[model samples]
Target: MIVIDPASAVPPFEQLRRQLIDDVSTGTLAPGTRLPTVRRLAEDLGLAPGTVARAYRELESAGIIETRGRNGTFVAPQGDAALREAQRAAASFVDQVRTLRIDPEQALALVHAALRSAPTAP
Candidate 1:
């Protein structure tokens, strides 16, 4: 299940992407587990199908998930190292934000603003 924050600064796709990654890393979504179809997830999250598709595409690019034609998407095999590294980086960011006494909501807003200003990579 994914939550969409229309008021939050983060894009829906990024939110979905981050949550999926976090879930996989935390074992809330185990490896080899099948993921909901993009359309289904988008509908459930009240997001555009393209938004969910983009998140799925990025996750696949990160090697966190895989898709096999009609077989559907699944958590990739061999992503433990990648997931661990990502978790470490995320934890460090959280620690830094906490150390700076940044309000959680404000930090999330900043993330959304920064992401909006960031240039897209080729």
Candidate 2:
């Protein structure tokens, strides 16, 4: 999920691109996760498809994400061991969610609840 601020001086494409990169770093968007199509995201954000496409293109060029023909874009894998483990866990969780046919919003809510209650390491 991304938000576009029309009032900001930063271009729409840059905003989209940067937010996605940040999401990847924060594990909000894990590697191998499929992204919404440019056209679909553009429609949702009220921006031109070109704007979204440009952002995707830039991300692809920077190795932050990749696009496969007719398959859609995905966050590219990272070199960090912790991130890889996180990606694996996320993929497993997603598979379990799909297998159980859980509502995505409900699943996300559960994850938020778990994160909130989880104890942090000292």
Candidate 3:
């Protein structure tokens, strides 16, 4: 379940996006699982439709989900070569971290730091 903390420093849309990404990556949300419509999710989370739409758009752009016109959005199948390679790299990283006995929180922090320092695409 996606929880939005009004008190959180992070924006609601980012919270939703991160939660959905984690769910998809961890297999908590299986491939082909249908996601709630933007309107419905916004209502359920007490957020604006535009916020949910923005999250959805970002996820779709990242190849994490797909929208079927009139049919609704579902988890994207793991067919993209780039996505598959990324998943493999992530799994390998996790294994290496585990072998080093690194705490998950610290590992995630390292990832966040790296992402922040990385250059953006043009």
Candidate 4:
């Protein structure tokens, strides 16, 4: 369902990246969803393969998707209980911030301050 507007101010790769991220985050693309291969997606979108590859690389770097050699790319599974809990907490925080109409910069500032005040482990 991803659309790339040829006349958009945003770069095509970035458009793809944001859409895929949004899909994964919102569960539109559930975990284990197999993404189209870079070449296939590029062909479908009428973009260069490198463009799709770059988007895939960025998503993989962000832990949103994983590439398994020969098996293709798929949405990354929630790996551990603690990590899943943390993700849920983060989603809750985002919802709360949205409800409060907090700007991203202000919300990030709050997070930074909280992080600075938190005690570190040995």
User: Backbone collision count in every prediction?
Assistant: 0, 0, 0, 0
lDDT of each: 0.84, 0.84, 0.86, 0.84
What TM-scores do the predictions have?
A: 0.67, 0.64, 0.67, 0.65
Candidate 3 lDDT tens digits, 14-65? 8898788778878888889999999999999999999999999988877889
Can you give the lDDT of residue 39 in candidate 2?
Answer: 92
lDDT string for model 2 (1-122, tens) is 78888988788998898788778878899889899999999999999999999999988866778898899899888654234545767888999999999999999999999999986521
**Which rank order by TM-score, best down to worst?**
1, 3, 4, 2
Candidate 2 TM-score versus the reference: 0.64
Worst 10 residues of 1 by lDDT: 81-90
**TM-score (C-alpha) between model 3 and the true structure:** 0.67
Clashing pairs in 2: none
14-111, model 4: which lDDT tens digit per residue?
88987887777678888899999999999999999999999999878667788999999999886432345457668889999999999989998999
Candidate 2: lDDT over CA atoms? 0.84
- In model 4, what is the error at residue 116, expressed in angstroms? 24
Which lDDT tens digits does candidate 1 get at residues 1-122? 67778887788898888888778878888989999999999889888999999999988877889999999999987767355656766788899999999999998898889889997621
| Number of residue pairs clashing in candidate 4, backbone atoms closer than 3 angstroms, sequence gap of 3 or more or interchain | 0
**Best of the two (1, 3) by lDDT:** 3
* lDDT at residue 20 of model 1 (Cα atoms): 86
Model 4: weakest 10-residue lDDT segment is 78-87
Record all residue pairs in model 4 with backbone atoms less than 3 Å apart, i.e. clashing.
Answer: none
On a 0 to 100 scale, what is the lDDT of residue 106 in model 3?
Answer: 99
